[model samples]
Target: MAGEQTGVGIADPALEAAAAPLLDKLVADGVAGKLAAQDPTLWGSDAEAEASIRLSWTTLHKSSRPLIGEIEALRTQLRSEGIDRVVLAGMGGSSLAPEVIAATEGVALTVLDTTDPGQVADALAGDLQRTVVVVSSKSGTTVETDSHRRIFAAAFREAGIDPARRLVVVTDPGSPLAELGEAEGYRKVFLADPHVGGRYSALTAFGLVPAGLAGADVARLLDQAALVADAIAADSADNPALRLAAALGAAHADGAEKVVLADTGSGIAGLGDWAEQLIAESTGKQGTGLLPVVVENKDAPGFADAGSDATPVAIGPATGAAKIAVAGPLGAQFLLWETAVAVAGRLLGINPFDQPDVEAAKKAARSLLDNPDALRGTAEPSAVIGAVEVYASAGTTGEGTLADVLREFLATAPEGGYLAVQAYLDRLDDASASLLRSELAPRAGVQTTFGWGPRFLHSTGQYHKGGHPNGIFLQLTGAADDDLDVPDRPYSLGTLQLAQALGDGQVLAEHGRPVLRLHLTDRAAGLAELMRAVQELAR
Candidate 1:
């Protein structure tokens, strides 16, 4: 097995050294022990482990290579068959990875990640007669994926396309998806190894995106990932992922409350979401651990240019602070951030994995589907009903003091409900409109809104950019002095430049949006601020 190895020359001795205490703490706290025991196969002989990891990673990369060939093939096939847009259908890990690949390679791809009827409706709005449907699911039983499969399959019949000619299935060999493909006589079928989880499968059949669309240098990508696997397998604590786990444990022990994972681009954004699930599912438990908080770069015109005038700028201050540390893979700084979040969760005595709340929300949503009228109520039954008066505080103070005030305010407010706007009067047109439209909008009382994940800014970008700009923007910002160098650009220089060009700070300032800026020298302070803000908002 390939053990962890460091990349040649690119290895950071200082980083390894700095992470020593954290690694030691992780080993001491039983986290290292748990992982070691859970997956000893991964830590076996370095060569073997490296080979295994590389095989999987490279497979994904290699899959894309054949994709270029496949693309030419697809183009010819499509041209002869008179097919136009290709619809790739999947959700979560299956869709996110491919979506990233397509976005990065500039392949125009449409993804179906949600079960919302409207989204599905839009995806099928095009010329189904000339469209090819690609249905992907590692498990093959994912309710949403299967639901979409049924929907598309029906649509295929409705459009008069032979199901055999237009449908493609990508899944594990013995999985239901594969079975369905065979039974339905789909023309193309791709199989992923069942051993790989949805997130990890990206490098396998799950990542055969380039092949599916006929774009990208899959071979080179595979080689690079294989090299990374080799390096990781050979190294010890110096291994980026392992070192990250160690850092997370240490930060948690240091009283950090949450892990803030961030990235600069869509590729990294998807990866961050994957990391969130990994940590949340793997380690989140026992009531005393750091929570994972994922952050993404906001979208704006001139976002690609780090130094462009219209780029968004990072506020000098860190807002929405938390105490838990952040870390991710070293090769990719974004990965480093993710790993840091895991490490911080461990240190904080919280599981970095597992999201019970998500399940609860899903359950609630499912129940709502059974009784559509149940959604009519704007407020929870227990919610207190009343009119609210707005008040604004001018002075800013430390978290401890602010938290106390917030707690007092919450206690004094009528138990029924109250909306606490940070400012007495700020543009709230956005919220008001949303309340009138969005099904999930809060009633008269309290609602929490903020931009965290980077991708959401894309969907909501228009509203934030050119729209009425009526929302209360509780902008959260953070900075770490320890910067990584970008492979193509000067590390986060692109990110920094984009931030400035968007005039992100100016957006809030000029719009007169209520803004709260928290400054922190490190991850811990940032998390603290975030928690305080959340609490204040809740209050």
Candidate 2:
């Protein structure tokens, strides 16, 4: 039912009944009020210190008000200069929200969040004079972002255009990116609130800058969130956040750990993709957590049926259809999910503020980049299946085609474990790759997740390496038709991308998770062959 005050609807008698006691207990404990007050103690003493700073996300709707005018002014100035094309070069949290915001508003914003050489090349091929690159990095030193910034700068210079006038920087204050913005004379350097974590900074400059420049009414977005901000913090029977948290907690306790989300005419676009990260990264730690499975549509997965361990969730206004439904304006939706994930964190006994397992892959990537030669030692494909070179990372699988490797590796997947297809390919040029997840679902008979490269490393990567360790990994890499070289780095974009995939694969294999690395000799042909193999396997 839609909340008269918050405009968010959550209706499911089953979920409400199962979670009623938990919700009552939460209200009695004043979880919502404590969260609203930014009381770090709500998550217990162990998480207090971290939660203290992370709670700033709760205040962003108000604190971020000033950014609206500034962003609007930038957009006006860009438009005046005929610089209408906006290309966002960011990763993970810094990129996902803006992508959703722009898409929901039906605006055109080119998101360059991948290192796929073909993708980067395509982005570079855009009208340079009309392009304004928004480089966002919460850490300021993210390699993919740095590479993007460097390449774009070089491209600008080659076109006799001034990067200082075209590039916009969004980073934490006093960070390297901020410093670079100043030194390079970027058009604008928007500093984000330091207190807000990357994933939780959707309303911060990290999200606002890109979407605002891309012509989204970001101020209205803040207003929408503000409408529910107060209601979200109230500990009452009607509190959507608390109810959502309780529902997830209760479902997990009921042995339904996989939360499958489907969009049933929500009007809000890509909410699942954005929420996927928040849920996966926040609670996915300490070896016990909720795994959010984002389906392309309501009918894409079979989670709604009986006897399934998966909890079906609808992201729309309809009631009594799914076990739970979260409906609100895009802004309210973002905050609702964030708050629910935080509360769910406390329920699951983990610090949602920290991502301890995310660092392992980063360190592994850095190490691999230090010595490119050793990166190829384990990369020898076990078999050449047409356009794909398949490398069995889980141990020596009997030599066979790509389908055979998938069958063997998937069979090794624990009874409840899922299949994660990671594609480090150009999202735009190779958009067909996203369909692989849905296609593999019927064939594999397991929950499927498709992550587009390095971005997922920052989101679900924590869960894969830290959460339940029940993930079966399938990594897809493609040969860059044409590669772009980073100006100052010894490696090309292709090298960095390969290192990322190899590094994650190495780490997953080390952690005892089986990873089947498939290299696409010909991206288009390989994707077709791989999809064909999956369809054939289903027969």
Candidate 3:
């Protein structure tokens, strides 16, 4: 490995020190140069096929230049028609990158990535005549995006606007969505690079179309990424990408595998959330991967509660306590982290390009959607505390006050284990439900991760089942006040949402992971009771 340092953008003394040995070895082996050259052999033979195609994202800064003009033209056409609102329907990276790009650029892009009826209804309730929906899916078969497409088509038609005029589709070249959009006579059909995987597609159409159409300077993002392309690709001791890779690789190697992440007052709004999926789904397989614990802020309970063994990494500026810090423009950060994670995969002895376990939950959800009672949650709750119905997967969480039961459930977290909080509720209306992460983090005394349902199933859901088996799960689902239908599907949004939660829970239980499932019989009352219990436990 080469010695000395020059351009460590993700810099911190402790992290650099911890990463030095691995960074040296990576540099000595010419990993950076090989990865920059798109050498599939870098991640081993098993991952070569995926790595070959996926590496195209590295050149998108130049290859995607043509898209900027097309996107700008579409935006102009939409504006001419008095359509200013842009709603994006996608999942995981397809939705996250665009959301982050638009947010960082101070552009407004409504993102619909959930199966909650209330959330879907909220997205559809806006001015339909003045809104254009960008439906994006890599597979062209994502249930959530397809459902959003159908609902938008129906909503536009009801408003006397031709569906083809207001609905745009983005997908891989020959994907079902591409065909559907073409056949349906949509306003525009953007074919993303088939080589780009959904999670690593920040520089592709998956990240640009919705963002550009929503008014973010998608071209400027490419320019920002270009600024750091050389820095990331260089096989030097100071390569920022290798710096991050070393920190993650060495930390995982040293057994401090849990990565506790914060925004660090960085101008970036949702980078942690976006990077969470990248790290989790990319490396969280083969029974080992870095678990990203994203806290809301420095004040979040996770900062105080996550055990001392966790690796402290910040997104924007380095905080005093951070061992590693990644600071850059949102666009540059995207390319840097994607490259870093790919390199980290080599260090971790895993195939970064393949998500081998993501389909388990999907299959389970499909079974439940097909049979409805395959998992059987229709039975009476194991116990009721206020409006919360508790369903313990295995051992009891102590039948007492909700707070007492919560304390027992949290106490069950194994040594060095983490807590996964999966909430299947309307994120918009029940945004406060997210506070459970902060509240329960201190109580659980473990790195606590919170994810909205169906979406997380596409993100950390992979890690929960595929990575190390040392995690306890907390699932929260609510009774939708009023549910919406899926246009032609047999199931309603509420049913599909619940099925997704239950399906995931079943898989977790099957994997021998402890699960505490709570059903909110009433959204408002149940959340109130849940907070009351969590606060009491904290006290």
- List per-prediction Cα lDDT, in the order shown: 0.42, 0.85, 0.86
Candidate 3: which stretches are off by over 4 Å? 1-15, 304-306, 375-377
Ranking by lDDT: 3, 2, 1
Per-residue lDDT of model 2, residues 392-492, tens digit only: 76565737766777777778777777889999988888899999888887777778888999879978899898888788899999998688889989889
Error of 2 at 285 (Å): 0.5
TM-score of each: 0.54, 0.96, 0.96
For candidate 1, the clash count comes to 88
The worst-scoring run of ten residues by lDDT in candidate 3 lies at 1-10
lDDT of 1 by residue, 74-110 (tens): 6577758777667777755576566655555556667
Candidate 2: which stretches are off by over 4 Å?
Answer: 1-12, 305-307, 319-321, 395-398
| C-alpha lDDT of residue 477 in model 3 | 94
Clashing pairs in 2: none
Candidate 3, RMSD to the unseen true structure: 3.0
Point out the higher-scoring one by TM-score: 1 or 3. 3
Model 3: lDDT of residue 329 = 78
